[model samples]
Target: MSNSPKKENLVSIIMPAYNCEKFIKDAINSVIKQTYQSWELIVIDDGSRDNSVGIVKELLNNDDRIRLYINEKNQGVSATRNRAISLAAGDWIAFLDSDDMWERTKLEKQVTFAKKNNAEFLFTGSSYINEDGNYYQGIFDVPKKVTYKKLRTHNVISCSSVLIKKRFFGSIKMEKDDMHEDYAVWLRILRTGVCAYGVNEPLLIYRISRTSKSGNKIKTIKMTYKVFRFIGINPFGSAYFMLKHIMGSLKKYRRIKFIN
Candidate 1:
């Protein structure tokens, strides 16, 4: 790390919005307010039926850092995000959902840690916002350095809280499954033998509404199965991992005990 200014460390943020008119402005502003600069913001519009694109346009007009992409049709979130990734130009890459907001220091903190420890890839901790923007408590039990075993039972990276070297994303084309696409992408990246690390600090605030596509339990279950399958894990182990994850989530958060 030198005091000299160089173009070697540009952090690009890829955020794709769809029908998030209520919160898109705040999300866009969060990036603009970041303590760490030298980043590009690529916001993809996934054929939002609401005023999401318009709000992004307004934000874009206000700040030249923001760029917008309106999809030709209503593609899934995965496609929209991949589009953003394709257009990004930075040494490091991060993803933020349209409905999520980051603390002003989120990028600065995570970038500092990655640079200091030489952890080329890492994810920051995150908080949750109820549909109405109320805070929700999180049960934190993340491993300091994530490996295949840790990720098997649960996913540790929030899409909005991740930052990685540009080489990682370019190596693996993230699959376009709407459900658990990010997780599947991570798994593929892991198979490439890159280590994924984590920061314990909660620097992101995620908005969780019942209307969220990921909130659908049935869909999550199906996606969990699909993600494991894509990695070529054996069917029996995939089923075991899925059950363990669902039940672990139920026990930890839902407070439902299960008996074998």
Candidate 2:
């Protein structure tokens, strides 16, 4: 494969919005400012009761690359993302959550890195920002490569940092809203003997929201257990993995710097 930027390679960015009026603008703006220009942003509003749709519409006036779809009812994030994926018209699919922002050169760098490494499934390291958009102290780094076994012990992949080929998705869709839906999909894909390449750059600026599901420690632990079981791990096996997951999480979070 050529190392030069493939101008013809279209990237479909999937963003699911749900009552995120305050942050959606920043999220979309981050995309609008991307150095990689060959991309279309598909924003699906999952029955947002707030002005998230209106904000997206306002931005739509200036950029034809951004498209918005509203859900008839409140479907969860997994379903909303699946719908967006179905509507994607690009060869590569990138995901950006409504509450997160990316570094301006995120796509440009990731695309170049992917091509250089011949990577079909790729992710990057991330830094954190609080709800007020203030930066945290440390970056969340990722290993150079990860497989099914490593990922099961600890999911270091943030959905926002993922840039994968559309063909690899095939029939695999995110499921089980209560668990880590994205993690489940990654596991299923990696189980097929494929490895996920990681770029240890803080390309993703993840927003740490106290209201988000992952913010609740107990709830997240429960969800982690479910993810193990959902992937066909027996009770004993799930318990073993759960212990590893918890220990890994504890160690991971210790390095992160939160707002004082």
Candidate 3:
């Protein structure tokens, strides 16, 4: 018998699109090229004032696994993801952003690893790319294992790299769009005594956008503080963690050498 996961191991990929017309097609194409065949792409367009929706529609004819939905208005990322989760039919849930791409074997390798280890929550390391899709010199490394406390100090799990069991969605849903919504969800899941397994390979290609919320240092600081508060950390404790978060962010970016 093959150790490979069966065809029934369907992975529902959640993608929230907004004004990412320039890269959305490439992102979708990356999914189409996945080595794992049992998967579905759920794309929710959050009222993007671009050709993002049109681009997705064009690809619908090529593959039946790709499904597209549109929001009536500009619902935030958290809400959009929640909506997508509600529609997902797979036993495993993976997230991929509209502007990012993945290695062709990302799903294949991650699924195999999860089955071998009996892991419910998993994420992989990422490599960086600029707005123009130029590669950065270094890869963002993730630890072999991450606990709740370790994740609180620094978020090594990129949203686009996560692959989690769908059962956890019963209680874990992304919230608080103004802050790090995905981070909050990951922390919440980990708080339940589940450790997240990490594959330290650059399976994800993260696109660094200057206009993104994380690009604004001051705004990111405020949001990081709010994440602690949202998770029931007191003001003093939040402050302590906030300092650690800042230090971690600095250390993380210092290693990435951008070619552009």
TM-score of each: 0.90, 0.96, 0.96
lDDT of 3 by residue, 170-203 (tens): 9778888889988989999999999999999999
Q: Which ranges in model 2 have alpha carbons more than 4 Å from their true place?
A: 1-8
| Residue 48, candidate 1: C-alpha displacement in angstroms | 1.1
- TM-score between model 1 and native: 0.90
lDDT of 1: 0.78
The digit string of per-residue lDDT tens for model 2 on 114-201 reads 8798888999999999999998888899999999989988898999999998887788999989998999999999999999999899
Candidate 1 C-alpha lDDT tens digits along 184-221: 88877776676788888778787767887568888788
Model 1, stretches more than 4 Å misplaced? 1-7, 139-141, 251-260
1 versus 2: better lDDT goes to: 2
Measured over all alpha carbons after superposition, the RMSD of each candidate to the real structure, in angstroms, is 4.5, 3.2, 2.9
lDDT of candidate 3 at residue 236, scale 0 to 100: 97
lDDT of each: 0.78, 0.91, 0.92
- Report the C-alpha displacement of residue 220, candidate 1, in angstroms: 0.8
